[model samples]
Target: MLYFVYTADRPGSSALREELVEAHWAYMDGFEFHARGPTLSDDGETATGSLHIVDLPSDGAARAFVTEEPNWRAGVYAAMQIFRFEDLVGRTMWEFPGPEGERFLVTGAAGEPVGDGVIVHGRLRGLDDGAVHGFAACVQAPDADAAARTVRDGRDLTVRPWCFGGRR
Candidate 1:
């Protein structure tokens, strides 16, 4: 079974999050079923949440995975959702092709029709800012037109992919 673990950071808890970053990674590294995941964002620089898509042997395993996370244990997370997902598409962010130094900010809505083709064309795999989903990705195309062409359909939400410092 594939599980989508959405976690939101607690307000004013940046200090606690910083303190637990290493421990959080360490805990995630210990997971046996983790697959694709990413830190959620809003502006791209500051992290606001996280998304973990993992394959587990059973519901019990999924439950255990969350209970053992460092942020949950330390109270740095304010909200989260565990969804049993289906028909998941899209590759992991780590697999997205781009220069090693290339990084950009992405903000948009959750794909449409939940179970339908939500997994359309896009390399982003996380959410930023609680209001709208945001993420950082290695844009496959140099421009939006080229990126849109890669999707199953040529239509998609605008992926204002901007470099870290600011728009070029």
Candidate 2:
């Protein structure tokens, strides 16, 4: 099963995050990730959160992945949201064909399921039977408004600046 892991950094935790970067990458190397990145501030430099879509065996495995991450273990995250996910675009962020411009993470209650112009697209799954209940996407757009419009056919959405993840 695929899991969506969204982790928000605690205020003043950048130093801690930097300190654990190597251990974090080493831990992540053990998993199969579909899409992974750091959520950025409006200026596009500071990392405010971490986003990852990973394939794991069960909800328990997903929880373990998040809780065991170096950042989480080191108290770099103020909050973490985990959900079962379905890959609608069926591709990784590395497979994105569009030009690398500004990117945003657009997510909300599932509406009409738009996949056009998305680098990564997926739906949040229900806890009981794995039915899709919400939608999410990482998209390249000129601005947050445009990114939201791309996926917001009629649902409430939250748009956050984002970028592709990994070493510099």
Candidate 3:
């Protein structure tokens, strides 16, 4: 199964995060990911949180991945959101090809987007109950409005300007 893991670093934990980045990356190297990256502050420099879409065996494995992550285990994260995800795009974010300006993380009660500029997106479900809950997407667009337009099924949605979390 695929799990969507989102984590936020506690305030002023950048130094600790930097100190343990390698350990975090090394731990992540053990998994197969559909998408992974850090969510940034408005300036696109400071990391506020992270997003990971990983394929694992079960919900317990997903929880373990979050709990055992180097940064999360080291007290870097202030909050975490883990959801069972169904990949609608069927591709990793690394394969995104165009309209290169700004990006956003749009997640909430939405799914089945029929538009372009979606890097990676999917339906979000409760890991425990296995019920459909919401959706998440990494979008590339001119602005937040355009990004929001890409996922038409959302009503209550959050569109956060985001940076893809990996090598260029």
lDDT of each: 0.49, 0.85, 0.85
Q: List, residue by residue over 1-168, the lDDT tens digit for candidate 2.
A: 889999999999999998998899889888888889899898887899999998899898999999989899899999988889888788888888887799899889855435456888888986568877788789888898888878646487888999888742
The 10-residue segment with the lowest total lDDT in model 2: 109-118
Off by over 4 Å in 1: 32-41, 98-168
Q: What is candidate 1's CA lDDT for residue 166? A: 8
RMSD to the hidden true structure, all candidates: 8.8, 1.8, 1.7
Worst 10 residues of 1 by lDDT: 112-121
Mark the regions of model 2 whose C-alpha exceeds 4 Å error after superposition: 112-116, 128-131
Q: Which of the two candidates, 1 or 3, achieves a greater TM-score against the reference? A: 3
Indicate the TM-score of model 3: 0.92
TM-score of each: 0.56, 0.93, 0.92
Q: Estimate the overall C-alpha local distance difference test score of candidate 1.
A: 0.49
